[model samples]
Target: MKSQPSLDTSPKVSDEIRKTTCYMCACRCGINVHMKEGQVAYIEGNRDHPVNQGVLCAKGSAGIMQVNAPSRLRAPLKRVGPRGSGQFKEISWDEALDMAVGLLRPVREENPEKLAFFTGRDQSQSFTSFWAQNFGTPNYAAHGGFCSVNMAAAGIYTMGGAFWEFGQPDWDHTKLFMLFGVAEDHDSNPIKMGIGKIKARGAKVIGVNPIRSGYNAVADDWIGITPGTDGLFILALVHELLKAGKIDLDYLAQYTNAPVLVDAETGLLLRDGDGKQLVVDRVTGALTAFDQKGVRPDLRGTHSDGALTHRSVFQHMIERYLDPEYAPEAVSEKTGISAGKIRAIAAELARVAFEEAFELDQPWTDFRGERHEKMVGRPVSFHSMRGISAHSNGFQTCRALHILQILLGTVEVPGGFRFKPPYPKPSEIHPKPHCKVTPGAPLDGPHLGFVHGPEDLALKDDGSPARIDKAFTWENPMSAHGLMHMVISNAHAGDPYKIDTLFMYMANMSWNSSMNTSGVIDMLTDTDDSGNYVIPNIIYSDAYSSEMVAYADLVLPDTTYLERHDCISLLDRPICEADAAADAIRWPVIEPDRDVRGFQSVLCDLGARLNLPGFVNEDGSQKYDDYADYIVNHIRKPGIGPLAGFRGNGNKAGRGDVNPDQLDRYIQNGGFFVEHIPAGANYYKPWNMDYQNWAVGMGLYDSPQPYLFQLYVEPMRKFQRAAEGHGDRQPPNHLRARIKLTLDPLPIWYPPFEDSHV
Candidate 1:
């Protein structure tokens, strides 16, 4: 071979820094990319960024590989061989988009709702709501079907908002930090800081898990509880706390609605003859409806406000069970742990609580400063992820945890459980500035069940009410049967709402949802004559092919993390007025590749093309920009960024790192805040004190009766108790007893669903 001419082997440096946010995970980190001669030369974390600091994880490090992967589709391809067979012919964007619109526009005109747009990591910056509404489809489901739907459901039943890791545990003040499933070192960086801080503060760490974790090395003790039995263990601790009388009495009495009963006939709260609602018994901490003779009354009284009550129902429940009589032994037997071990854990927790409360006059802290102290503690909060739930009897297990939290008085406190906010953006269309509303309404029951309050209203393309009722109704008449009803309806009269076009964004449903994957795929393929489904046109924006992509007539190219504009909107901040004084900001460290456009750009284009409405310019015009500009402008926009700027420096206009100065400038510049903007004086309208209160306040008036906050309570206890009271006609299958609980009836346990325990 001839000698090769001398050539430069060193990589060249290029000047290209495009900002974007990481959608790979919920962290939503920001980044700035540096490209070299149109090729990826090297990767560096955007240290000036506010979210990730200068730190990047393994996944973050692999951004270049992901963006330049061989499997990536550089151009649109048509399926020349067969669907899902990976056979294709490259096509231009014009050819692809035109073909997609041709098939979609007509189907949309036919039946709009039958179309289902399943998306994953919808962490895109796009105004997705616009696309769904413009298309007039009610079935814009997401990856939640498999991931966090149930987690949201748990929050719905308790806090009324989806849970976020925003509430910082007071590790600085805590003497004992009991880290649950969250293994500190193994967690993401942001989380690692909190855990690291607590440890540094010299707090004693008690790591609890089924198996030892890296965090276990930091722990003073490891409580090896069986997987999924953590709730029971915690509840037993609550029982011990009550027995030892270690609770914060004033806090419990002032905050909880623990005392109340309802009338059997009325289904509304029961009150005394004086019109005062009956209270739960302080001694038993149960509803105060049982007569002196211990006989439950048939008719409970009404509340002082003449609203229905359920104090009696819950009162009877606690008195009949959950008290000392029911005991830790009962829980122990059901959970497969020994009573001695349960009592021992409870004792250690009690000791920690007494010392932290009585001696310190402040919350105890672990070595670094977390109060999750398991050593003689009062009641530390216990949280669970999908690893603990998502079983056949997940609901029951969740209920047990909620009850335990309530019993421990851990709801809404620092170093304890709290009902925090998910943060909603203000409505730009309102005349008086909807975002400037009061902080809280102190509502009794949920406004819109299951979804975030701000997301309650389903906005059309124009940001107006779509199908007002159908959109907000969390409980469809046939929802209990899952999406099967929609399938049947589509199979027959084509879905009732009639869907024509389906657009999926970053979703790979085949391996995600619990439903039969084959069925879902077939349904996606079963389109109408116009190349629509029970949908017309299916367009998907994703990184790879999965079962969902098999049915897509058009697959839009998606930008990898390295190729997109980065924004940081989800960093941790002050959760309440008290914590508002603390300042913290996180920035992105890397930029996305250039070829891929953020989903926001796609939505902006689609919105303009359809001329739907809402996302207009400040001059009451509609000059919508690409997704990158939308994100940058939204972050840098006036009254849209919060009181603090992205940079903690308090310089509102500062676009790079966050700092105190940036925050001050941000406030002056009308920065958008995570908290609900306060309305003027007298703007704090009390929505509801509880369910009954909400019913009357909202004018869904009913005669004073025992009320259940939940529209329907289908707990297995309801059916089990009925079966025991009646004959042996086994209760309905849905009502069949699964998980057994001393608090209720029946004791059931299901094996964890993982293919391997480890």
Candidate 2:
């Protein structure tokens, strides 16, 4: 009674704040997870972080539910029943490792191509791709091919940078914004924040998409055009701009291949006797090396050097797009926009881009050491996403959008589509894909890389594609991201070849991901005449019980977001802003009560089990204990590791030695590190020496040559030539003509499939 009367009351302690990145989706928003009594209390976007700036999207906000969902797989599971019955029994990690290695090792020894490893929504692509290559499988791809490869490939090949975070809109200065098919896209939060800025500044916002929601809802006007016809719509805009003589001549002359003369006969770049590209001098009308100094190029004219009859690419453009078909009146029925409205929008675009140009007072020097007192900008900016990229004509459609932007000089200017860090690499300067097949040994390089011509195709001695998915072949030469959507069907049909195992991560292949969900489910469970499963085995990793979980032969349960170590590295989709070159990491804020392991850690463990080349030390020991050890010590190159910050002996970032304290440095800095981009290095980076040096220093580019815009893509032309039986890597007879058509160097407009049939 006396003790009860004493009544000692204790107050609850304040919640501890643990900073990390939100991995709910691929946005990688910076978040601060508040810990109350050793439990997650709440999560908020980091106030000082550059990517989100204290704000988060719905996906980021819903991360707690995503992590703590009841359906999350908590332990390693091996199927005890038929494949799709979802029957499973928990097993130790050691047994799981042995099972995976037992299934995969023989395939690697006898035929590595028999193993196809694909990933989806995975942030650690470099890791997975590296593993796939070391495991000696030529079949590997991320989800980008069916998602937005058009956006990326088109931007990279045409303008030197593409949208999935490689470039961004200049929200601070853009006056007229024309967005196509970009309602809710890859850059969700940053786009939301950008839309807010553009709106607050009272700039004109025009949505060129069908739906009027999300970003479209905030638009001052929604064009509501028909889908898959944006290329035609953009061509109409170009037609009107050209008819009205609203062009950026100086920008074209200095920045693009518009002035680069092409062989009128061959449809190829005009080369001089010494093999350098030739350009016609505007003042002298004489042919000169395109790289010649003091050469003023005439962007719009035809000239003859008495031998080749060359014409400027600008003149070629006049012949291609200044047609009656691209006229608004001609495409109105297809685009669902009136002729008058299309012309009016085009005029507005021209006015904002050319007449209402933006200029900054910062003085800078170009790559050629030419000094400029002010920086010039086109105030019109454009961005598009899945709506334009998912079509069969998507590649050219993306090219049309880039052509429109380049014509307006809206690339890398004060108020234009400025490239993000590690971009503006010599246009489409991709290395060859690793296709050499061997037994029980890794390939020479990463499995997935760019294929410039037929030589890069994964072909057998008979010239048929060696990879099961048929990526980088004449069927889809520009499939920089392999066609992941075709894998399940192809494997089921054994169209290319049968595979021993189909290893996928995070993708929901059995459900909404399939165009025909029921068909995919059937394929997943399909059996052969021998009464054995056609696709012998399936291995999948998922944090939650997705539709794909039911079909897996082995399930590697992944840890929740708050209980894993992850890196949003510069090598694979850095979470950087337009103004900030940033990357982030996440360490366990709360220990997992369950037995789930992070996918990256599992990958490392599997790599160690298989003794894949890069995963072991010179002494044949496990090189990395786990993902965290790999992140801290696995050098991507001589001076670079996963985290770019806190690197080097001096801790000087961008170029650095692997600081053992790199992970600690990231944690101490509130979970992210961003170096302030200097004012001089922020814009006009295609040739800005300061920006180029910084970019190269950060290992974004191999060399600092001034990156010229490739309006005339030579690599595509090479593929076309190869299709015509003129090169080492030629397509099969049936696929040659088709390759030639799709690999057109210049952008062309064609009707969508339905329109063509109708």
TM-score per prediction, in order, is 0.64, 0.95
For residues 300-361, write the lDDT of model 2, one tens digit per residue. Answer: 64667477577788887888788898899999999899999999999899989888886899
Which lDDT values do the candidates have, in the order given? 0.43, 0.83
**On a 0 to 100 scale, what is the lDDT of residue 607 in model 1?**
48
Best by lDDT: 2
Instruction: Provide backbone clash counts, one per model.
Output: 137, 1
Off by over 4 Å in 2: 1-14, 272-276, 301-307, 511-513, 754-758
Per-residue lDDT of 469-517 in model 1, one digit per residue for the tens?
Answer: 2322212211110232133224324522444555667666555434567
- RMSD versus native structure for model 2: 3.3
lDDT of 1: 0.43
Query: Positional deviation of 161 in candidate 2, in angstroms?
Result: 1.0
Model 2: weakest 10-residue lDDT segment is 5-14
